[model samples]
Target: APLMEIDPRSPVPKYAQLREILLDWIEESRLGVDDAVPSERELGLTYGLSRMTVRQTLDQLVDEGKLYRVPGKGTFVARPKIEMSLRLASFTEDMRARGFEPGSQDLARRVAPASGHLARVLGVAPGDPIHHLERLRTADGEPMAVERSNIPLALAPELDRHSLAGRSLYRLLEQEYNLLLDSGEQTIEAGLCDATDAKHLGLTAGSAVLLLQRRSYANGTCVELAISTYRADRYQLHSTLDARR
Candidate 1:
């Protein structure tokens, strides 16, 4: 429907009508990734709307990750996001299933004292030894997420002896230490990338991001506390739902 016209008398707001029109254009391949969107003035004139309404529609699409703005330039269509299923799986496994080669870059690895919050989550006492591992996870050599993992040092004393770059931490814990993670609890939220993480993820500071906090359990004991930050432009979480009477 490249020539689909908005019905001004159909009781729908002009901004919403224009929004749907633009979405249809993108879906129909009339607009492609990196293709510039019409200027606010031009869109308003075409859709019989005020410039403010057109700007509002554009802002909504931008926030939803369908468009991006370039300074001193105009807005353009963005790349489609990757849908990530919510399940108990390692990043390596997930990427492989999606046909993307997964890899990691070790940022920091050391034995450190457990913080009060982390100690409680891992069921360890404060000041206890903990293995802290930070890495930049990648897919097809593209930066995907920044992950920081904490494991009680007493549970994996020899963890430092193994190289984790380009490997799955969960696999190592299961195969080498026999600490299989049978279950986990995870919470996700929207956030803005910070300067430190943005640098590693190839994004500017304050970009939209997804913050994931997970606690993995082995034999009913919490074994891992991981906090990961994923680029919102590249990832969207999915879950299946069941209806009941």
Candidate 2:
């Protein structure tokens, strides 16, 4: 079905009207994941609205992670969301428990000095040598999240030799490095995907994403600080809170 016309005289904003129509189409399966959305000019012409209005509407949808755009190509629909639990476990372990095949594409692996933020999290002095690993994690070949982790070089020197791509980082830490992660703290917040993130996550620039910052510890020593951004539409963090009787 084609997009519905926006009543020019209505009080509802034109951009908002477009948003609702697009959402309805998606909900009704008129538009499926990876479907090519109409261009701004086409949509504007069809709705009798200005091109600026259409651009604003499409931009908002992209920001909400409802759409994705490829450079030199057209905008497309995003993939369905994947639920992520708040339980403490390795990425591979968590995915396995959820019946999803976990894999990763290592983006970068190098030894660098800890930044100010990383130094605080890892309890290392700023400028101290640290091993950095950047990866795009996936489940059954579908992109899930982009993760960047920093570890003190003194603790995991052999980390550079391991093949992290398509493997579990936590499992490698335990079996190969003889380290056990006892506990960790995490913070979650909403964030917009930048150009680099959008490219890796297959989203439009400025798309809404969930940012997670975590610090893992072993024997009361902070061992790693990881920053991850998960696609908002593909992930929801769930927890069950209880009241003491």
Candidate 3:
């Protein structure tokens, strides 16, 4: 344990000052996740503070979900939460804007016939050839989401050759093929992750995840169908709803 000094003349209360010091230590990785912290009595003696003050600080941290306490054991640092923004933006752009080193792992890519549901969504005949691409998206070396996309084969035949793992699909469509994405409609739902999804997303099986289905159109023609799953704990969907006139 390093020497911790509390400024008696500081404007902040003693308990809050102690809590901030502990939090800074955790954030700086001086105290790692699940690492046991000093007990209230020990911390009090070390800082020359009352046991009640140390306990108060610890209790506040626990309430804020930054620490966990066990009856017989002691308090331990909690894992940090990943923050996600709810906005209308491309995944590639979003990851880059956040200063995260983003990359994608291509799972599969093949030209296959569209099924009934896919055909209906794409406004094409059943069994029409469509290009399917599946990828796992990562940010800052962490698994973020799994994206599966379907595109009309005739529209973007060279999509299979392009390396999509580290770039934006939307940019590829516009830059490589001169296709313009006019607009898109998206739907969101909550569901538990399946085995393959869990493995790729680095989440425990049956953990809650957000399922997003989107159909994008270009030049008044249906162009893409995308299905994505995002970790629920690290994401929240946001939209502004306006009342009807």
Q: For each candidate, what TM-score against the reference?
A: 0.90, 0.70, 0.68
Query: Mind giving the per-residue lDDT tens digits that candidate 1 earns over 1-245?
Result: 33978797989888899999999999999999999999998998887889999999999999899999998799999988888758889999999999899999999999989889889899999999999899999999999999999999989888999999888999999998899999999999999999999999999999999999999999998899999999999999776778976
Candidates in order have lDDT scores of 0.93, 0.87, 0.85
**Superposition TM-score, candidate 1 onto the true structure:** 0.90
Off by over 4 Å in 2: 1-80
lDDT of 3 by residue, 123-183 (tens): 9999999999898988887888999999998889778898886778889988987778887
Q: What's the C-alpha lDDT at position 205 in model 3?
A: 92
Clashing pairs in 1: none
Report clash pairs, candidate 3.
104-165
Which residue window of length 10 is worst by lDDT in model 2?
Answer: 79-88
1-245: candidate 2 lDDT, tens digit per residue = 56577988889999999989988888998889999998888888778889899889888988677897887788888875666777668889988888899999999999988889778879999999999899999988988899998889888887999998788888888887777999999999999999998999998799889999889888898888999999887897666789989
Q: Higher lDDT: candidate 1 or 3?
A: 1
Model 1 lDDT at residue 212: 97
